[model samples]
Target chain A: MTPPSGPRKGRPRNADADGAILAATREALAELGWGGLTMGDVAVRAGVAKTTLYRRWPSKNELVVAAVAEQLDELEMADLGSLRADIEAVVAQFASLLSAPETQAALLALFAEATRDPLLRRRVREAIIEPQKRLVLAGRAAAQSRGELPLDTCEETASAAVDIIFDTVAGTVVHRMLVSGEPATPDWISSFATLLLAPLAGIGAGT
Target chain B: MTPPSGPRKGRPRNADADGAILAATREALAELGWGGLTMGDVAVRAGVAKTTLYRRWPSKNELVVAAVAEQLDELEMADLGSLRADIEAVVAQFASLLSAPETQAALLALFAEATRDPLLRRRVREAIIEPQKRLVLAGRAAAQSRGELPLDTCEETASAAVDIIFDTVAGTVVHRMLVSGEPATPDWISSFATLLLAPLAGIGAGT
Candidate 1:
């Protein structure tokens, strides 16, 4: 329902409206693409007034970033028994997410736009990239607890290792599915998991 | 010089004009971005008639793919004496290219557009993705020759390995540089190269 008047900055935001608006943003992106998606259309789709949408998201870029972030939030890493199994599960999850039509349509466009706009780039990194790296962090902790990975003595080296692992896993899947135009099939995921585990095991051994 | 008339389908294309047009396209992408670039602007920048530009590339997608492919073509892998050295060199080279303003501006946008357009996706793969995999293949062969990596006996398995390696190398660099908004500096490259070598050595040993 449209608020009688737009809520003030401190007013409690409507969780329903937030959900609807983000869902509508993703729907519009899938149907209309990045160029065709507009704030007004998203508002109409969400059954909210333009002012309500604008009051929440200042611009289309911010709205789309939030929508994409919400989708990425669905990615959860369960502690599979082994490090290899955990890697495979997460890789499969990420591939499936990227394969979604809305994500397929929105992500690269967002990254492209972020290239020229510093504010938008920071927003994207904060909202999407940074949040997703938590999966890597969590997975690493789980692996270490299992004794599959060794604890790093040097904080700097440990931090850098997380960055490398995150980049490799996320980047490899995105490239295989999007850039290379290949399917991230079950067999492929298994092989990739094996490939990843090798390097990870090496890190654990401090090689 | 402008052709007296647009070259016929069978006539030889002007190499200089082709080069100038592609260069102009990159310049426009860096300055105007994908949304703002136009065929007319590219023609003017190339000092060629619009017809000539159109004759070679029927659409903006085709033209952009060609321009991006030309940039990717510059990437070559030399036998840097060891797999680690070779991987590091190619990774550094790819990162530098992705760092350029025009590539930063154009690549993700092109990939995003290709998500929906099948023909453009094919062109991107044929011109850019497929060709770049050669570097991975060549590097693998070189490593095998040096006894740093084992040769695969199965064609299917070997092909899959190439795909995985290519995706890991390119995707990681692209994600680190573009999506994560982090510099793929020398220190990062060394860590990445070391990580890559471990798994590669495992694969060579038939693990």
Candidate 2:
């Protein structure tokens, strides 16, 4: 049974196999955490050859980025008409996504590891951060269109707000999750969202 | 001379040792980063002893917390009687302080580590967060008196904004420092200050 073509013909390369591997990575990250994750473990958990796993990703960080991207791509951004509504809607929903228990655990590890490694940091920015940044930038654009925010409103500022929401919630919620054995609730996200988003709506103008 | 144990002994614990140790901690944190710091190192740097250091503080986190506190405490809070002025002044200065390379590295390490260690997190919260919370609350109170930010504006949201600002500037600035080796300067801090504080004053009233 000789394989033909360029890097192909390997038991038909099951599409679902990639998905399962990612899911396993997510589970392992949640269960064992960042420092504990290993390619050998992921391979065993995925029922794949260590060679097969390495063929797909060169490093553990690569595997982590793939897992993050796949899990996160499923989260769609809201597109409410106005910037205020857009920000509010996105923030409201983001509150839920960010506070997800498994994701929270994985992200805590990612952020922590990023403190020590530069390559991993770039992967996070690329695989996880860029997409989220696009959403934030889109919301900022909507706000400008609705005339709620100044045209010159630095998207970076608004973008920073979104980052803040996730980071703080990540920090705060992870603290709660580890200590209390509970996921961060949506209500908590909503509370933080309102705090950060209100400024964009120009609500305190007269004041 | 094991005598004279009324209150304490050995040079009576020089009042300036605390300040000197804190200075040494900052210097070490800036030069070697957090992972490189130790009570022994701090003692050696400060011209003290391992025993004297332990007598004063228990752990590296505690020592770093003290250093962080000293630098941060010296900064003035903006209770300028106007929410706009108050927030601008307080946060502007915070961004400035965080912008410093040594301060940024030390604090980020402390905070990032806090995500994993509960005790350190608690100490950081106690020393840094509570006072900042008071500042935000007092600013809110000032707004209340002057009828600026709505009474209904979520306090957590307001606080999260502060948290986001602190962490984002830290993350972004440090990311830049690590990437570019450029020290965050007063100019960068002032620009960030102008971007956030000016818009933030409009918070509660928006949408």
Candidate 3:
């Protein structure tokens, strides 16, 4: 199904062109790295004109964020019978995403660049980091429904719990794969899930 | 401290020069970023000859690693009377180190570059990552001695537990400060330590 047309647009934006451009950006990142990638190269790869690329994404940072965000959106939490199973499944999915050459090459470089550019940092947070928190929320709700976790009463406390949980899950997987130079194997995932479950179920109970 | 000399070839290495070069590398990383940093510029900044810099570290990767490793070595875990206090103290220390402009600029970039270079990745694992795991070991031993944590019978299980704890602590802190673009304040640190304590104490007991 085609997305409904919106007001204040010149030509109806081409969804196919947008997909091609984002795909090209990821492909370029995998092959050329952040330093070597250029708008011209991406445009050529996407089979679009330079003007077209520029009209869509004003800078490399924005373009890369869009590409990475699209990929991150692929992360989803399913009710896998128990909190441990749900955690492990999502972790495995995340590990698989980070293990990709394109993601490995793009993510840290974007983050490194973001340290210097506040605008890019905000783009990264909004596009990539914020959306991924939904997994934590979804997981929490599923566990609560299953009686695996008590329902959180305070809104502020629940939000804080989500932040901590998101950081722990994402941070551990990233550090394990990117910094420690270790594979997030099934064994490692199982161990990590085990470590996380007790605390996860205990969140908002008091501490 | 200067009394002992190792058996090696050529003149004795200059400790002062090593310190200057590493310090200069960090300073340069803060100002110039990874892409802009060069060996010649670092040598000049350190008040050393290009040949001297080359003799010490063969590449930018090695120089950055040495600089980063030296800083990482400063991360020491004090007994601090209790497990939660120890964990929070070290988490604060790690967060402080990461909050520095030099470390912030260099670490993720080094990790990003290491993804494509196998030799650099090995150097990072050996120099930066492996040493930091000692903190986890120290914390665990202290906790066990205090009877806050149970002693593990299996060596392999103990090692696996260490890896999980290390990754969770370090990864959560890094993600919070760098990726999430949030401050790892005392409040956040206290909450994180609370969340970690129960699971950490239970690591090798069963799951």
Candidate 4:
């Protein structure tokens, strides 16, 4: 992707610099966390000048927001002819996202920042959370409109359900990785998708 | 209550000192937040020796935990006329725990500690979390046995519902408070509880 602004410096910007910066952000997040990452380090790792980095973004929070937003894939909400299918498919996508090494690292860093910095918290929520919640709420509404889902489902409830389903998958995957230092398998998504939708049908969908 | 095991300290250990300390903890948490509070400040306000304060709870973590636990009132699953009443009662009690000034403060501190301290995290999950979950499961079982809930409603699902309900409530509540400096209310629980059961009842329990 081209830079939004025209560049003029000692040398033309490296086309691969953005990717390098993103990768470094991911690695730095996993190893050192959000608090430990510095603008100078990011600039050095990306092979960009401190002045050039500052020119592009005013703050580290802005830079991180861009990285997290660009890296975490929005769910593919497929219309699968059933509410269960739609919810499960979206949840399955989230599980895959949680297990992805790059996104997982980025998100862990984001969560750490959220604990300490109010500005970072707002940025993360706006960049990553608000859009994902919109997707879940819209999907729930789509299912309800088709008569496949209970009509009483509200946006907040759907939003809450998304947290329940995805957080557990995220937590379990993190547990597996932290406790055993093992990678999550693709099979976990299917099991998670099935187990997550247990309350969506019959009479158990209140959550 | 007398000192658990100690020679009589200065000033006869003021019979009301413990209450004063706990009250001070609540006030400090509500006003200054977990990160902003200090033991020296609490000692001054409570009119107690720093040594006496340390004698009660060795560290800030231990003090906050004890303070939170003191505010918690265990709920009994009495046989209410309907399953809704029983469930609602338990939720109300649980909400009270989180909504209280001291408990919420302690919980936010614990959640922050969870990111770094593996021991604190484990203790939080086991001592604080597991017992609350067991209550929801046991309460659900009581409903099932009384023909208020379906026999097929898995205890795992019930427990998960409770977990997300409380967690989301906490997450959203904190988000609101942090951004707007408003207090989190209990109003969400009524609709939250109803919608939680709606998915279980399917279309039969119409909106």
Candidate 5:
């Protein structure tokens, strides 16, 4: 696998450098938080020049988003044999992510900044949120095929269901962890699952 | 209503001063955010001396919590005859509050600040988050009485349900408005309500 030729001349951009910088960003976020994180410090931690860091990321917010998005890429969908189990697994995974001190700090700090900056907010949505939401869509489609949900007669209904479900699942887990300051323990997850899936499953073949 | 007598104070500490100071704090939060807000600046905005402002609320975090709490006081639960209607109404109310620019800025700033400060986190919970949570309890009780939900089999189950409901309702609305940057429009509300209540009602009559 030969590397594709760059439009430019000298030394091809170091792909490993990107990984190192992002890893350093996450570490800095853990120690200093968003308010205290500095581009110079991140560059030092990454063993790269400040100019190189700036040339790549342009801003601290963009760099943090990229770093956080890399972690979120690991939140994959699992085919755990049932819709309820899959949703519960995702909920647990999300709860763990939000509970991690580094992710929690970075996420809230980014949210605060996003209140004033639309472009940054969109970056967060595209980089961090949109990928996880795809899991909800996939889970729903799996459920529908298994007859756990009614087949939507229209695209609008399907889209609406996805949005609502995404909000409810993600929102509930986040609120519980961040706002309410409660652990998403196994017992709590079971109770939430019952409330969430009971009716939808009732509409299935068994009922 | 008779005011409670203080231990010893000049002019019984004019009650209007508290109002003016909290209002000023909110204004400063909107203009300067948590990072830029200062007690002295707030004092100037309130037309009160810095010492007087300090005497009332010892720290900026405490002052901001009080001001934000006052705004949350406006989020009263409406008894709209049905659980679904009540939930939808509260969701709309919360969406409107969160969507307001001033509230959006202040809430997120406070959240970010609270992340590292345990005292500030508790203050936020007691002042802002907990008060609105009562609506969840009230809504649940109302639904139980109307036969829209079952009588809790035990205290633990009842408590768990309340926590889940509160998080789902508040979290989804917050995420939609703040994280997702989407409007919680009427159509969205209806879709959310149907999904939320359908399950609870199913449990009620043992469907």
Candidate 6:
């Protein structure tokens, strides 16, 4: 039952299994939810042995985090010529992720588990949140370059702005989508963008 | 195990049981977490019959949601004269709630469960989220009176502003406390209030 491949060249086959496993995880989440989802079921759906899945992901938390992180990898930050547009596009993308039935369900489940498990929380933060935060950083830098956001007086101030901006942008989307159970509609996104950019515009225009 | 009391006048006994049950739930959440917690164990902890607990709360989700709602009832929005002080105070209060091990754990667990259970979601919205949103409406109204937030042009615009403000305020506090793993310090709360009110202040001042 040994693989006829070297450790260095295990990417192709492993990639296929990983893809299938993640897809199966999503399917399981959609059907069974986090409480009912089992590694054995996921492996069955993935057409892999339970041992294979266990080898790759030691626990359900690890598997779900990996699956969600893979999904989050699709979030892209394109330079959309303006900060408002860029922010809106990212917001829209995030909204879509939150609106998806399986992803939202799975993401919340991971968050719940993370609250009890420090290691799982760290994994989720690193794999899911940290990458998206880079998009925030990039957008801020772009806004500064476009003369939309003022350059902070000090590094401390800059970091603080980034933290505030990150929480404002990301947190609002989550609240609107999940907490309020409201759709992040185009009109809503536009209104949010306007509200978000108002202060930045004022600062940029020296108001 | 019949009590020597009139069936119609069971308020005192029920209230005592409710308090004991909620306290036991928090203790169980702190010890066993959401995954490990069960109604039977909680009933045992509360020194109540399993049937008594089940008759009151049909499931763990319902029980936990009720227990957490009791905690959330403490989130009062007192008017501290100014929008800034009011917001900072509420933010401080919310930070304290999230910092509590039992409440944070239970809140996230309920949120996760509600993702799949529509009934549970409705209960949570009604009992937890909707009630807190009143504070947003009140704060906005106060800001308008104080010439901090401009008066809305129409009812629709006013509702939209409330939604925006609610999401911004609640979402940012959650992000700071839960996601960023940062304390909502006094200075941090003050800065957050200032950042939040910046654009609104401009509109109010006609800048």
For DockQ, the strongest prediction is 1
Candidate 5: which pairs clash? none
Q: What is the TM-score of chain B alone in each candidate?
A: 0.88, 0.69, 0.89, 0.72, 0.88, 0.88
lDDT of 1 by residue, A1-207 (tens): 235677777767777989999889888877766666778899999999999988877778888888888898999998978887788899899999988878877887788778877788899998889888899999989989988888878998888788888988898899888788788899999878777776667644422
Q: Against the unseen true structure, what C-alpha lDDT does each candidate score? A: 0.83, 0.59, 0.83, 0.57, 0.79, 0.80
**Order of models, best TM-score first:** 6, 1, 5, 3, 4, 2
In terms of docking quality, model 1 is medium
Q: Give per-residue CA lDDT, model 6, range A1-207, as digits (tens).
A: 124554674444466888899989987886666777888899999999999987777677888998988888898887998988898999999899889877877877777777777887898888888788888889988888987777868998788877788888888887777777899999999878877777667754532
What is the TM-score (0 to 1) of candidate 1?
0.86
Residue B19 CA displacement from its true place in model 4, Å? 4.8
Across B1-207, the per-residue lDDT of candidate 5 in tens digits comes to 123557474566767888888888877776666556778898898898999877777677777888888887998788898888898898888889888866876787777767766777898998788777789989888988997877888998788777788888888888888888889999898777877776677644431
- Report the error of model 6 at residue A75, Å: 1.0
Weakest 10 consecutive residues of candidate 1 chain A by summed lDDT: A198-207
- Candidates 2 and 4 compared by lDDT, better number: 2
- Per model, kept true contacts as a fraction are 0.64, 0.03, 0.58, 0.01, 0.50, 0.43
What's the count of clashing pairs in each model shown? 0, 7, 0, 6, 0, 0
Ten contiguous residues with the weakest lDDT in model 4 chain A: A175-184
Q: Per-residue error at A176 for model 6, in Å? A: 1.2
CA error at residue B112 for candidate 1, angstroms: 0.7
Local accuracy of candidate 5 as per-residue lDDT tens digits, A1-207: 113565377777778889998888887776666656888899999999999887777677788888888877878778787887887898889888888866776777777777767787778888788788799888888887887777889998778777777888888887788778899998888778876786567654222
How would you encode candidate 3's per-residue C-alpha lDDT over A29-59 as one tens digit per residue? Answer: 8776666788999999999998888787777
| Tens-digit lDDT string for candidate 6 (B16-85) | 8888998899878766667778888999999998888877777777888889999989988878878888
Better of 1 and 4 by TM-score: 1
The lDDT, on a scale of 0 to 1, for candidate 3 is 0.83
Q: Candidate 6, which CAPRI tier?
A: medium
Interface RMSD to the true structure, each candidate: 2.1, 6.9, 2.3, 7.3, 2.3, 1.9
Displacement of residue B51 (Cα, Å) in model 1 is 6.8
